[model samples]
Target: MTATVGALAPISRAACVGGGVIGGGWIARFLLAGIDVKVFDPHPAAQRIVAEVLANAERAYGMLTGAPLPKRGRLTFCASVAEAVADAQWVQESVPERLDLKRRVLAEIDAGAPAEALIGSSTSGLKPSDLQAGLAHPGRLFVAHPYNPVYLLPLVEIVGGAATTPETIARAKAVLDAIGMKGVVIAREIEAFVGDRLLEALWREALWLIKDDICDVETLDDVIRYSFGLRWAQMGLFQTYRIAGGEAGMRHFLAQFGPCLQWPWTRLTDVVDLDDALVEKIGGQSDAQAAGLSIRELERIRDENLVGIVQALKAGQGGEGWGAGRLLKEFEQRLWAQAGGGAPAPDPTAPLELLEIRVSPAWIDYNGHMTEHRYLQVFGDTSDALLRLIGVDFAYVEAGHSYYTVETHLRHLGEARLGEALTCTTQVLAVDDKRLHLFHRLFAGPERREIATAEYMMLHVDSRAGRSAPAPEHVLAKLRAIADAHAKLETPAAVGRAIGQKTRLAAPV
Candidate 1:
């Protein structure tokens, strides 16, 4: 579990301390987002914790991918915190929320981690100032608080203390961004931070309501579940209230609430802490209401609800923290210095297209098997080899001419799995001035048994013309040789697709 920096850096490995809910949550989020994770938790249930967290993460990622996740980033469970932190660029500590425990972990992390690495404590209430008191490099330590189910939630509040540096914050932000997270930086570090402070204020008011017999816990939840809570899902307080005032907006709402600020209303302070008895009562009531639903079920409901709300906001076609519909325009142009996006596939008959390809771990799909699309891609590779030999260069196409696949017939004969070596061979079946017929066969590399076969009809095209055209002289000559050689043998039925309208038409029919 004590992996070297070299091993994790290639894939951007992160370290998580404590395999409890929060630690496990961090591991799941990072790993599922294609970041390798090294975990250290003394609890015997660490592996199970990781497995369950992975399962949850996988489910969440599945929603995004619309299929099983691609080969996920690797996961490593460490024997100790030092081993986990040894080479990690980002170390997230989720030990018990006790100040001494955090102080000890941060101190140990500072000793083991690289001087430039960021060490974040996932404490909901403890201030970064208190946590950094015992650290050797206090600047590297900060609060990286995440809401529950970090895998699904995109928001992370980054609170840095007096000793924390701007560079450290930027480094942490870069890592989060790479993992598809949106981070908001707290201007200044404070106890309970922003999110927790807001939640605590609500909790304090809710407690007062329950204690004074104003409303039951479920009823208070209903008020939130139905009214402002619904609006808050997409927009926060000020924005929601601004909309409530119509044309008057924020200035109007502020002017209205400004007068009520001094009036005695609900308490937002923590003077009435919920002691153990109250905590137990609330826990019992929650269990009574939700005992029928499993934790996994609850997570599903939560994620689905979030996705619906966020997607709705996104549909509104506005900017963040406002209407959902934001117009996103994407522009991309590839400089065609050469003709193609990739090197031509190795030829099977000639030295050019023939290649000994080793199957990588990424080739497998959600079924824990090689996917059909990859086989097609490999065949496409073979076609590229055939075209390159005949002078169908990428530059030629960019200049206005290209080859288009009119038809392809493919068959999977045997299963190909990960770590398998495979061989692909492409042979020309027929050729004319404007079209080339080709077939490709894939075989298991070691045993030399055929695994898949494909036959395709390739049509010469003037991409600039958007129609078929005759091959250039040099290109036609290469196609002639391959086609002439294949004509000696019996061609497969799939390779005999009918030729379309050729390039020499004087006028439209």
Candidate 2:
């Protein structure tokens, strides 16, 4: 039952054999991608826990991207493994890590699922070969390891066993890609794969730090989070080190730091004993660090923080070498294209509906409303949309002629809270060869109550010359057309208002 890439259809329905943390996360990821999920977990609390995970996933997804997503798929709790995998196009086995238990579950799923369906094991460290041993259609079985909070993180490690075929790996990659996951295929089955091995190494060192009483759990976390963790978020270790070479590059860096590797700085070669006393000490410290927050609360904090960091990266705030942010931006563009499709037809009779956005948790201030800065961002996005509508795209900008905002006046009429939907409508007030004036209004909810308004004056620039220039003829024609259509509507009163009110009385002493 080896399945080729061409044979694999977009997975409309998926099955999960276990509904623990990892399994439930898988269900959330699938459901968020609009794939119906059938889940089987023997524990009575499975349904409740999975539902909680799904809720968290929904929040994370809402904050991750502004691109429109498909409607959420259905979820069903099945009575048994056979029932769960019966009609699934993809079967994900996330049972316990024990080899025997996983093997039994894999066999059950293999027998029940269609032969053409791809079967993936969510084993963290167990070899896929052992899980697929003695199973029918073993070629379809492979490992699809994912990070925690699966719906938010995009990386998924795809590993195949001895009996697994290249076709199976290809099919798995295709499915993962469709769901907005980056599938890094392992050339050979290895213990813990790449990410876990790196994580395990760090975990071992962190444990030794605690065991040796060198630092508490909180201090260790701060050390990483406030320093190297930030560095790793964009450029990883190698690139960071290369930059540290101070004009000499990697060769110089290695020469200077190579000898320090022999120093007793790390305990990677030795194992730390996790005695009862040590475990209690570590657990107590962790609990105290969290204060009184529940697991769900901690997860929300984590997801929100992750979204903020990724968003920063996407904005290029982490600097030029931020590879992760660059990748994220590229991925979001793809999602936008998939959702928005081809260029929209110009409509002259009305204000152009340019941008639709969901207020991410990161955009909210301490007052629990969208912060003032985000209004500017929304208006900027709307302006960019208008540019695109009039034939100014990446190529136009690259050609050295594009619009640059010279001035903006924003009026905040109301408040927008987190997760609230926002839309921006743009009207081309006036346009000439060198300058364009736009008035944009922000509305909230389906009824479209006004939330804010922005008036922008932009000048066309020949970027190479660093001076004003007439826009290309095609772009000017489009803008003129939109302006002509908008002329039928009454001018907004706020369009020309100054920041201060008119003085009704003479200056008072």
Q: Cα lDDT of all candidates, in order?
A: 0.69, 0.84
Using lDDT as the measure, the top candidate is: 2
TM-score of 1: 0.63
Tens-digit lDDT string for candidate 2 (1-509): 00011111278899999988899999998987768899999999999999999988877766777654566778999999999999998999988889999888889999999989899998899888888899989999999999988877778899999999999999899888777777899888988888899999999999999988999999999999999999987787999999999899999999999999999899999998999999999999999999999999999888888887777777785543145455567665555444433434646788888777778777989999999999999899889878877777666788888899999999899999877778899988999889999999999877888999999999999999999998878888888888999999888989887775463556689
Misplaced by over 4 Å in model 1 are: 1-11, 66-70, 273-277, 318-509
As for candidate 2, its clashing pairs are none
List candidate 2 stretches off by more than 4 Å.
1-9, 317-321, 342-354, 361-371, 384-407, 414-421, 426-438, 443-450, 456-491, 501-509
* TM-scores of all candidate predictions against the true structure: 0.63, 0.82
> On a 0 to 100 scale, what is the lDDT of residue 218 in model 2?
97
RMSD of each: 10.5, 5.4
